[model samples]
Target: MLEGLMLGLQSIVEPQHFLVLLIGVFVGFIGGALPGVSGTMLIIIVLPITYGMEPISAFILLTTIYVACVFSGMITAILFRTPGTPESVATVFDGYPMTQQGKAGQALGIAVLSSATGGMVGAIFLIFLAPVLATFALQFSAPEYFALAILGLTVVATLSGGDLIRGVIGVTIGLFIATIGMDPLSGIPRFTFESAPLLSGVDFIPILAGLFAVSEVLRRSRDDHSIKDTFQKFKTKIFDFPIIKKILTTLTRSSLLGSAIGVLPGVGATTAAMLSYSEAVRWSKHPEKFGKGAPEGIAAPESANNSAAVSAMVPLLSLGLPGGATTAVILGAFVMHGLQPGPMLFTNEPQLVYTIIISMLVINLLMIIFAKPFITIFSKIMNIPYSVMGPVILLLCVIGTFAVRNSMFDVWIMLLFGIIGFYFDRIKFPLATIILGVVLGPIAEEEFRRGLLMAGGDLSIFINRPISATLLGFALLALTLPLLKKVFSKKTQPPPVSG
Candidate 1:
């Protein structure tokens, strides 16, 4: 293990590899900071460029970009309520609220540090437990996947900002949004209403962009404020002892949870981040503080998403399975290089596998440095009055939404949802619940149908399998947690003092 680690270090720091790291990190930073650009998109654009490089060098470049992009995405989410990628959606819940409270520096610090920590933890797991995790991941068939999605849905209760009923309603609307377009199994359109564009379904990019970004601009137009300069407090000190101590448990738990979830093929970092945020809320003593600038809230999703992004490589490197969309693209790069990533790849090129894993860890650490100056510079955006910033943000939302498919229909959908989001906020509905419904609904539906097919519609397959059953049990726990917290708070409350 030490020899492999040393070899990876030697390979990555060589002048050519080192230069690629700088370039990759720089490109990823800009890509992720720009709303609507995803790590998958960045990697795809660079895929042709990697063709001329040695296979190992190419992978190092891609891996660096993926790691840096995932972490840097929280920049916009914290600074503005814009999630640069779907994976950072959960970050906006508390991160932007922290910005509202003049704690933008602390929020950015927590996000960056937690992301680095999570990446290191995931890299360790990949190094030490790839075989075990890959074996575990393979157990997640249709039934288990369905149960996992159910567990993810239970997060809606926690994200409600204490209004479970409004949260449920928001989610109902979101599920309807998810069911638009054709039925995956039957090839029948459900909610298109005969519209040609609706046949393709509403993409999450536009809806999410509208939900957080466009609505935010509309809201700010009502009462705009100049951004405060909080750069001095934005320390890149990775081992900030006080903040680390405050969120150590949430960070560690989320990292482990995200790493475990990321091992499953098809399950992306978004789910990991959402579930981790939910679990943090589930276990925290002050659940009500979650959506109101909680440090734990910022740390949980940031760490989880970053950790999941790294551990996602395990299946790709070990079992010839792509862990998520980005890894699927990375698999294409592997093929382009005439290298297959599976057991044989490991057996044939042990150093190569280790080098990729080690490079991921190195990149995560380097990101703190890579991101620090950028954060300092971006912090200056706070000085831009909303008068100027609002129009620019609104434009970003429209362009980002339109960039997804280069279709004006998407832009219109985003504009429509921008109004809906404004109304939802007017009524104090929790935005996270709507997002969760849209995100998890399709996963649940697809997996549930497949599980039934596997069981001849017995319905017991979900409970008959231990992993599936355990996850379902966790879902039940997630649902009842809010009630449990309410009950506990009541029981522990002292008698009201006489007026």
Candidate 2:
């Protein structure tokens, strides 16, 4: 292992490999700062270009891009309330609120710091715990996955603010939308209404773009006030040691949570972020401050998503299983180079694997250095008049949405979702809850059905497995805890001052 690490370090320092890493990081940063442009899309675009490159260099470039892009998404999410990727959706909850309060620098600074910390932690786990975590992840079957998804769905309580009913309504709406495509088991459509595009279900990128980006545009358009007048001066210094110290606990907790969740197949950074955000709120001393420019808010999701991005590579490296869409693309890149990524890869190409892992650590440190100047530039964006910025954001939304599938159908879907998002925002509904439903509903349904099939339609399987039972028990507790607390508090409180 030491010899492999030395060799990997040597390879990354080579002039050509170093240059490729820098280029990848730069391109990834730009891609992730643009709304609707996800790391998966960027990898797909750059995959062909890597065909003529050396295998090690290609791997380094792609992996660096993967790590950098996950962190970069928080930049736009903080500055403009627009998440560059689905993983950064949680960042928008607190990041944009901070920006609105003239604390864009602090928010961006925390995001960069937390992301770097999380990435480093994940790299450590990938280096030392990959095999162990992969073995543990192997224990998860359909029943376990279904239970985990249910546990994740319980986060709706945290996102609902004070409106649990409305949150459930939002989640139901999202679940319905997720069901629009073909049935996972049967070869039949449910709610496509014979539309060819709906057969593929709602594309997440366009929906995210519309919900956050286009909706913001419409909301701003309704206001007669000029954006420039309300804009605060951009802060130049991006680091705040005091704030960093303040949220170290949240950062550490989120990083661990993200790395753990990332090892599970099909559960991506998005879920990690949402779960981390909910956990942060749960453990916080002042949970009411979350989603209102709380430092812990930015720290939690940014850390989790970045850590998840790195640890998601564990399953692929150890078991040849892609943990998420970005890693799925990297898996294709592996096959393109005539190299497999399972346990055998370790023996066959030990140095190569170590090089990729080491490069990720270096890439994350470089992101921190590179982001400082960029944060200054991004913070200035808030000063632009909404009249000018709104149209540009809309154009980017249209172009980015169209670019996702190269279909005009997606553009229309984005527009429709933008309208829906605007209406939801006006009605005080929780958009995050709906997004969570859309993202997790399909996974839960498919896993539940698969578990039933495995059990020959017996419901006992869920509770029969210890892991699944524990997770479901946690979900049940999570669902009932708030009400239980409310009841208990009422019993303990003084009798309304005996009035």
Candidate 3:
């Protein structure tokens, strides 16, 4: 094990590999700072450029971007109400509120510090546990996978942001959108409207860009609100050891929970973030203060999401199964280099696998050092006029979506989803729920179908399996608790937090 660690360190410390790591960190920070963009999108966009590079080098570059992007996303979420990616959505609840209260620097500082710590902890967990965890993950057959996917989708409960109906509506719309392409089981098209491109279904990148980036652009254009630049006057230092210690103490359990969830296939960063946020709320001394500017709200989700992002690599690196869509894309990079990930990877190329793990740790540490100066710079972007910023964002959305598949159909999809997102926003629906549904619905359907087939069409299969049963029970709680609250609670308006 020590020999493997040494080789991994040596491989990534080279000038060429280190240069890619630097580039990746730089790109990732920018991507995360930009609302509507994410670490996963950044990786997918740049993947073609790495086609000719060696497997380890390319893996290091891509994973570095992924790691840094996850952390850097909190910059935008904290400074602005806009989340840089879905993973950073929870950051905005307390982070933007902190900014509004003239503590932008402090919020940014905590997010950066906590995210870096969580990422490193998760990396360490991955290094020690990936092999053993991968063996356990192999036990997850279709039934367990489906149950886990349902459990992930249940995150809408917390993500709905105090509007349960709107959250349900958002999820329903997303699931409706997910059904727009050809039927997966049947050969016939479902909602393609006879367009050939829809046969493969709505692509994830464009839908994500449209739902988040373009819609935000359009909505912000209608508003005459200006971002307050309180950070300029706020004298706050980034390094707060006491605050870091406190955050670590509060977030350790949540971070571990997120890492465990992330190791499961089909679950993604958003779920981990949402679940951790909910758990933090549950454990908070002031539960009612959650939607308000509670520091723990910022810390818990940021830590958990970053941890989840890193731990996701475990399944991808050890087992052949892709942990999520982003990891699935990473798998393509591996295949491009004539390499396959699985048990064989352990025996055949320990150095390569170990190098990727080591690179992740290095990239996470680098993000903290690199993010402080950039956070001040990013805070300025919020002050840009909405009118001028709107078109530029629209253009980015168009370009990013088009770049995904070089398809006009995707561009159209972006516009249509943009309209849908705008309507959802106007109706007070939770857009995050919709995005989660769109992302997870397919996986849930696929795994459920496979599980049923394996169980001879027995509906009891979900209850019969131990992991499946536990996950299903958890899913039921997620789905039902809000409804129970609605039915039993008093008819009083909740206190408004600083938005």
Compare the candidates by lDDT and give the number of the best one: 2
Candidate 1 TM-score over all chains jointly: 0.61
For model 3, name the residue pairs that clash.
none
| 216-275: candidate 3 lDDT, tens digit per residue | 667877776565545445544568777777666557877788788777654667788889
Top-TM-score structure, candidate number? 3
Cα error, candidate 1, residue 418 (Å):
1.4
Please estimate how well model 1 matches the true structure, expressed as its whole-model Cα lDDT: 0.79
What lDDT does candidate 2 reach at residue 170? Answer: 77
All-Cα superposition RMSD per candidate:
8.5, 7.7, 6.5
Q: List ranges where model 1 is wrong by over 4 Å.
A: 1-122, 125-131, 228-360, 368-389, 426-428, 495-499
Q: Considering TM-score, which of the candidate structures 1 and 3 is the better prediction for this target?
A: 3
Q: What TM-score, to 2 decimals, does candidate 2 have?
A: 0.62
For residue 241, give model 1's deviation from the true position in Å: 13
lDDT of 1 by residue, 284-320 (tens): 9999999999999989999999989998898678755
- State in Å the error of residue 50, model 2: 13
Off by over 4 Å in 2: 1-131, 223-360, 375-384, 497-499
- Candidate 3, residue 368: the lDDT equals 73
